[model samples]
Target chain A: AQRVTQPEKLLSVFKGAPVELKCNYSYSGSPELFWYVQYSRQRLQLLLRHISRESIKGFTADLNKGETSFHLKKPFAQEEDSAMYYCALSLTGGGNKLTFGTGTQLKVEL
Target chain B: DVKVTQSSRYLVKRTGEKVFLECVQDMDHENMFWYRQDPGLGLRLIYFSYDVKMKEKGDIPEGYSVSREKKERFSLILESASTNQTSMYLCASSSPIRPARGGYTFGSGTRLTVV
Candidate 1:
């Protein structure tokens, strides 16, 4: 079974401060990891995927196979960055079903 | 751009009433999914379909059912709505033909409240 765990429910940070949302997964095979973001009054959207290796909105996540972690990080938090972030995992040949974490509510205070 | 659209933005229903949540996608993708979002639980997959008339039970399929009679449409059905079922419902679509690197396209979501 594939499971994703996001330890933090709420993360508060001052503007310009670095932000990191932790995520860990349990899967026997190589996994595809993604970070989905839901901004205020907006639909949930894909922020970044591990396979893309491209940063969107200054957010990046590196998949660590050894630790089975894919933590989302940003160099500096902005007020506009406040939103709900969910970490998801998908296993190859697993029908592309996404197993999502509990999610982290990020609040960037100005 | 791919667009996945949920039929409703909000819905209020009484307990025990039959409820239906509809989703449509214009990208002609082969896959469609239904998920429910709760405050701390994130998005829980309720059901998904890979082809017309083909459905798969997701992680939390209890108290819910789905139909995919058409290639572009999927509908989630709640035989008896319950308070515990009140939450934001999201729909998404993706194509396996594309590189797995391309993530899903999601709908705006429908906020359902069962009283």
Candidate 2:
């Protein structure tokens, strides 16, 4: 079975501080990893995917096959960057069904 | 832009009542999904359809069922409403061919409350 784990439920950081939302997955085969974000009163949107390897809003996540982790990281936390983040995994070519982690709530303090 | 729309922004239903959550995608994508979102649990897939009239059970599908009579629309049905089923339900759609750009397009979500 495919599973994603996000250890932190809430992560509070002061503005301009570095932020890292941990994400790990359990899958035997090659899997696709994605980071999704939901801002206050907004719809859930895709932040980035491992396949793309492109940074979005200063957030980047590298898929580590050996460690089975895809941690989302940002150089500096911004007030507006506070939101709920989720790590998701999908089979590389298997119909695109996703299994998501519990999620992490990031609070950027002023 | 591709748009996935949920029919309701909020709904309240009594226990044992049947509940229907509708989702429609304007894009010609081939896949549609229904997920329930809770505070700490994030989003759990309830059901998904790859093609019209084809449905598949997701991780948490015991209390839920789904219908997909059309390619662009999928409906999630709660057999019997229960307080445990109260959550924010999201609808999403995506293309199966483009794995690189197959990120789901999601709707605003429907907040369901079972009393």
Candidate 3:
């Protein structure tokens, strides 16, 4: 079975500090990973995907197949970056279903 | 921009009552999904529809049924609402082709409370 695990339930960091949200996945086939974000009173939205290899809002994630992990990272955390982050995995076959992690609440404090 | 809309932002109902949560998408997507979000448990898929009148059970489909009479609308029905059923329901839509290439579009989510 495919599964996504985000170890931290809550993470606090001061503004301008580096932030890293850990994510680990379990799957048998080639993995497709993604990072989703939900801000206060905002709908959940896609932040980045491993395949795109593009940074969004100064955040980037690299798929580490050897470690079976895809950690989201940002060089400098901003106050506006406080939100809930979820890691997801796309099923390998033709279906569009996704398995999501429990999510991590990131709080950037002043 | 692709848009997925849920009918309500918040709702409260009594136990054993029948509940209906409606979702509509203007993007004409082929895939629509229903999920319930809970603290610590994350978001668990309740059900999904691939086409008109076609539905599939997701990870957590118990106590729930679905209807998709039209391609643009997907409805989740709780046969008998229970206190444990209270949750934030989210509706999402995505294209079947190359779903990995493009991420899903989500709604504002309906926060349902069963008292």
Can you write out model 3's per-residue Cα lDDT over A1-110, one digit (the tens) per residue? 88899999999999999999999999878878999999999999999989889999999999999999999999999999999999999866737887899999999999
| Superior candidate under DockQ, 2 versus 3 | 2
lDDT (tens digit, per residue) of candidate 2 on A26-108? 99999989999999999999999999999999999999999999999999999999999999998867689988999999999
Q: Report iRMS values in order.
A: 1.5, 1.3, 1.3
**How would you encode candidate 3's per-residue C-alpha lDDT over B69-111 as one tens digit per residue?**
9999999999999999999999999888763333889999999
lDDT of 1 by residue, B25-102 (tens): 998888999999988888899999999999999989999999999999999999999999999999999887536433
lDDT of 1 at A49: 91
Residue-wise C-alpha lDDT for candidate 2, range B1-115, written one tens digit per residue: 6399899999999999999999999988898999999988889999998999999999899999999999988999999999999999999998887644449889999999999
TM-score of each: 0.96, 0.97, 0.97
Clashes of 1: 0
- Lowest lDDT sum, 10 consecutive residues, model 1 chain B, at B95-104
Error of 2 at B115 (Å): 0.7
TM-score head-to-head 1 vs 3, winner: 3
Judge candidate 3 at residue A77 and give its lDDT: 100
Residues A63-109, candidate 1, lDDT per residue (tens digit)? 99999999999999999999999999988877788889999999999
Q: lDDT (CA) for every model shown?
A: 0.92, 0.92, 0.92
Worst 10 residues of 2 chain B by lDDT: B93-102
Candidate 2, residue A34: the lDDT equals 96
